[model samples]
Structure formats: C-alpha cells, structure tokens
Target chain A: MNRKLLLAPAAGLLLCCFGCQDTVNTVENEPQEPVSNIRDVRVVTDKFLRDRLIIRSVRMATAASGNQVAEVAATNARTGVFSQAWSGITGENPYTVAYKFVWMDEAGMAVETNLSAWRTVQIKPGETVFFKSVAPNARCRDFLLNLKESD
Target chain B: MKFRLLLLPAAALAALLSSCATDSHYVDATDTTVAVKNKNRMSSSDWVVITQDAGNALLASPLFEEYLEAYRIDAEAALKEAEAAGEKITTREKLTAMKPLLMLSTIQNNTSEHIDSKLLTERLREILFNSGKVRFTTYAAGEGQSIDAATAQARQLKNDPNIKKRTALKKGTVHAYDLSLAGVIIKQTAQDGRNNEMSYTFNLTLTDNSTGEGVWTYSKEIKRQHKQGALSW
Candidate 1:
C-alpha cells in the first residue's frame, strides 16, 4: 500500500510540524499583565491603513476586577485579529482625540521621548475605532504613529 | 585554532545574554488617556456655589481658621450676653443675629486617586469659600434664580396692568431666603456589594438653595485598597 500511503502523509506532516512548534512556545511563555483601561480607543482608518493606522482597544476594568463581569472581564489586547475592510462615519463628531506612539531601538534607532511618560484612552459615542504602534519600548523593535486634535 | 577560541567565548556569552534580556509588552493602566496612576484626578479648583450665594457663601476651607475661630467664639459669647442685658447689641449686629450656622468637614479621597466626584466637590467649594465662617452652597453651583424666571420677575414688580393693579394673584414666600450645602464623599470600596475586608463608601448628598435644610456636614474615607507594589503596606 504505497508504503503505507507515504507513511501516512509522513505522519501527518510530522504532527503539523510539532504542532506549530508547540504553539509558538506556549505563546512566548505566557504571563503578561500591565496596561490600563484604554477603552474604545479607536483609529483604524483601514483600507490597508498604510503605515499601519488601525489600532482598536477594549480592556478597562479595574478597581481590582472583583466579581469580574464588566461585560465578562473584557481584557482585550492580546493582539492578532484582522480581517480588514470597512468605511463609515458621519455627523455629530466635531473632532477631539489624541494619541501618539513611537519608539524604536535595537539598532533601529529612534528613542528618547518620555517626559515622564503617559498613555490613557477612552472613546465611545458611535464607535468605529482603530489604533496603531505597539512595541511600547521593550528596547523597542520599532513603531510610530501619532494623531492629534484633542484639547 | 581550537574552533576559533571556541567561537570567541560563544560570541561573548551571546553578547552578555542579549544585553540582559527583557522584552515583553502590554501596559494599559486603566487607559483614561494614560498619564497613568489612576488617570487624571488632581484638582486645584473647579468650583460652583450659587444657590443665591447661600448667605454670602465663603468659608470653603483650610478649616477657614476653624470657622473663624468658631465664629469668633460665637461672637464673643453673644456679646457678653448682650452686655449684661443693657442690650445695645452690635458685634456686627450680634454676628448678624445668630441662629444660622452649621459646620462640619471630612472629604478625604486622599489621592491614590479615583477622584472627580467633581474634584472632591470642587475642593469642597474652595475650602468652603475660604471659610468666612460657613455660608456655603454648591450643589454644582446653580441657582442664580429662575423658578419660572423668579416668580416672573416678582410678578413684574408686583403687577402693572399699565403701572398699577390689584391682587389678581399676589402671595408671599414663594421660596425666599433659601440655602443648602449638603454632604458626604467618604469612599472605601470592595466593589459594589462591598467588603473585601472593608473600606469603600461613596455617598454624596448635594444641596443648593431651596433643597435647604443642611447646616453643614462633611465626611471622607478614601482608602484605595491597601496599595502595594507602587508600595504602601
């Protein structure tokens, strides 16, 4: 039997390549928490959002999360979910929002901008958000994107 | 060459363990626009005390010298009992004919912050309007008169069917000489149903003008959960 059907598709492609390398080393060795309630913090202006301008938010429940259920403990921000494609917006939005992120080093240059650092966000009143630039300085691998117009 | 000196001490111990490795990310800090540390909340002032100036409101507080030394020792013991009864009274007319005072204070949210109960009631109405001896009002500072345009401009200056008319409707005290300062802000939370070992109370009782009946009572109890890590305990 064709050598046991090519060794049963070579043992199902070697167990799908070691089960995708054991799920990327168990998600880079789990455990990660520290980022505060950046609400509906939007800004995705998709359309392939050149220079990457599609960052969305969801995760803001603390007063020590007790009995959880802030819409079921929505800590959203494990990044990785993008289907892209959308267009819609109009009225009652005079404009007033702020965000700016940039930091890169690791021979990639660009850093030095932390005037006693900060980053808090929230936005909801007809949502349609997006955000960009994450790599919040872990010796920053690279990132940059800013948006202004809030007073 | 012993394998290029063992590959230069394994590339200098892999560049000294990748320059003391450390690269993991995720930081929100309750992102209320991230200035971190309990988003926003750090007021100096954002007041409001107009309930028809609650009897010359002011005495907002730094214990306005403890209510001006308890209203100058209750107007020097009611002017030595009106000068031993000879009665020629007038320590500012016996502190404006006493019987209108109610003092109290305790608005502690001692910043580890979750403030903005209107910035601790606008710094307790600027310390009870610089404590001129309690006569404050600040239910969000509103009451510049308008219960139907002040009884329709006091009924057009007591009526005027062309300057002169009778009692087609003229009564009195439709809400006059009113005042209010109300109380409470004490906070210590274990989350709603409360009790994570106790310390959570948020009870605000605002008042201004006609909601009257509030001679003064302030309270505080913000012990934002025995902090830790940023350190405190």
Candidate 2:
C-alpha cells in the first residue's frame, strides 16, 4: 500500500510537469524572395537575457529616401523552454517586454534622433516578434537593440 | 524585565517597518519599467514615447521630404534674385528668409484631468525644429495683442537715433506662416471587474495655410491599466 501511494504521487507529479508545457504555434507565409543583407554580430554579455530574448535574424533594407532600415526577428526563449511557467504557478496572464533601438552613424556615434524610446510589447510562449526601425537620416549606418523585462 | 522585553520587540518592529518604506533615489526618466501612481493621467514617460514616435514618423514621411526639397530650390532661387537686385544679403539671411514658417494652432485637451498640452507640443516642436525641416512660431489666445505691442515698439525703435544704424528695426518685416500644426488629445476610461483601463489618443494634423488642406495627419494611442483598488478613482 505504501509503494502504491508513492507511485500515485510520482505519477501525479509527472503528469503535472507534462501538462504545464504549453508552447506557442505559428503559421506564416513563405516569402517569394529570400532575405539578403543580414549582418552577423557577437553577443558577449547577459547570457540569461539572451536565452529569454533570442534574436534570430536581422535584415537591412533601404527606405524611400535611401536611408537604412533594419528589421530584427526575435523570439521569447522562455516561452519555448519554460512554457507558461508563470501561468502554471498563478493564473492566465500575459508577459510583457520592453525594447528600444539606438541608431548609430558611420563614425560609431549615437544618432541624435527621437527614435530612441522604450516600447512595450506582450508576447506569448515561444512567439517570434519582428521589430523594425528606420534611420533618422542618411547618416545612420548601424543600430543597437536594447530589450528588458517590463513591469 | 518582561515589560522591558516587550518594549524591545516593539522597537524591533518599528525598525523593520521603517526599513520596508521606500527610499528616495534617482532613476532614469526614459525607463518605462518604473511603476506610476496614477494610471488614468498622462505621465512624462508617455509624452516621451508619443513624441518620439511622432517625430520618427514625420521624418520618414514622403511629404516632409518633398517639402524640404521644394524649400531648398526656392531658397536658392530667392538668393540669386536678391543678389541680382543689388540687395547686400548674407547666405544666412537668404536661407532664413526662405525657410517655411510653421504656426502652432490649438491643441484641445478632451480629458477629465487638467493637462497642459504644451508639454507635448514643446517636445514635438523641439524635435521638428532639430530635424532641420521646419520652423515654429508661437500662437496663443492673446498673441495678437503681443504682436501689436511689438510692432509699436519696433516703430519707436526705428526712429530712435540712439540705436545703431545696423541694428535699426525694419517695418513690415514680419514673416507670415505657410503651415499650421494642430492636434487633440482625447482620454477614455473603462472598468472591467477590479481593473480600470485608460486610453489616450493623440491626433495631430498639419495644414497648408494657402489651401487649408491637411498635408499630414498622424495619431498615436497609449493604453494603461491598473487594479481599481490600487489607485483611487
């Protein structure tokens, strides 16, 4: 009887673990033209933050005025791994993250533009979000994206 | 001794409570993670975000680019004409004389709370001016009286012999604006269960003075929600 009781609790714990794993599913149309002008960079700090906000790819394009435009694709790694950990512990609630883009010139100086404001967005488990920004002027050649957990 | 022990516990409790209180410290104004006490009213962070978005959109808009190009061509032509007419004008004078003037119209605040929309307008004006695309002029309810007073003062200064010849005030030199910027900020509130939500929509329109037609219009919405009990209604 004791063995059966132990097995019952063990099975229940296993079921709970598996049941809490709810990940996001997405369907997107295939692009006719492949993405070009993607630049690769190194991520050195904040491994924990990197695991949560995974930047998949970055594509550069030109605006109508010949200014540089960057599109960044990032996914929530926690949503894929933890999969509704907060909702499982408490109740159904969305998680929000704040992000901002900093534009830079050819001389590596930060552009004095008004595009550097924190914007908040809510993401589901394992969902990928695309953030886009245009250079303030033709002088901007590079960009840095900053992201953080929102309250 | 027992009473003394009771007093010791009370002192400890008081210390703990004081420690739990929040301490005053400096924080970044641009950081959006900081919790705000009033969710229904517009905050400084909201103004920053809204103005940034507006400036970015305006700078990227094709209409603004077109305006800049047209203004450059007109400025060059005007400079050439002034030089041909034997008017001794510097390059800066010619450029400033041709730059398009923008006047600030009314910014109606349709919210229940008393909000000085100037906070928002000033940021927008600063951004637009910094972009090197437009110039702003002050327009208020009693601006006519101020302009008349300034005109009278200029007339008196023009006759004053004490004034230097080079610094003499010129008559009929006021530049009229070619464009006007107007906007409205509307706030809406709703309640669901124990949660209260507030939405602020900022709508702005740029009108051409000659045609009285809106050349560019943009709107930005910011929504904030908080627990009903957390903030007093």
Best by lDDT: 2
Q: lDDT by residue for model 1 over A59-98, one digit each (tens)?
A: 4221110111111111112122121111112221222355
- In model 2, the Cα lDDT at residue B47 comes to 79
Query: Candidate 2 DockQ score?
Result: 0.45
Fnat across every predicted model, in order: 0.10, 0.38
Writing each residue's lDDT as its tens digit, candidate 2 over B51-143 gives 777876776778766765776687679778878999878655665755567777778878887777766666766766765567766522211
Docking class of 2: acceptable
Which prediction has the highest TM-score against the true structure? 2
* DockQ, structure candidate 1: 0.05
| lDDT digits (tens) for residues A1-151 of candidate 2 | 9999999998887687767676677787876666435666755466755776777778887765556778888876665323565555654335577878888888999976556777777776678888877777677888888777665
Q: Score the docking of each candidate (DockQ).
A: 0.05, 0.45
lDDT of each: 0.36, 0.72
lDDT of 1: 0.36
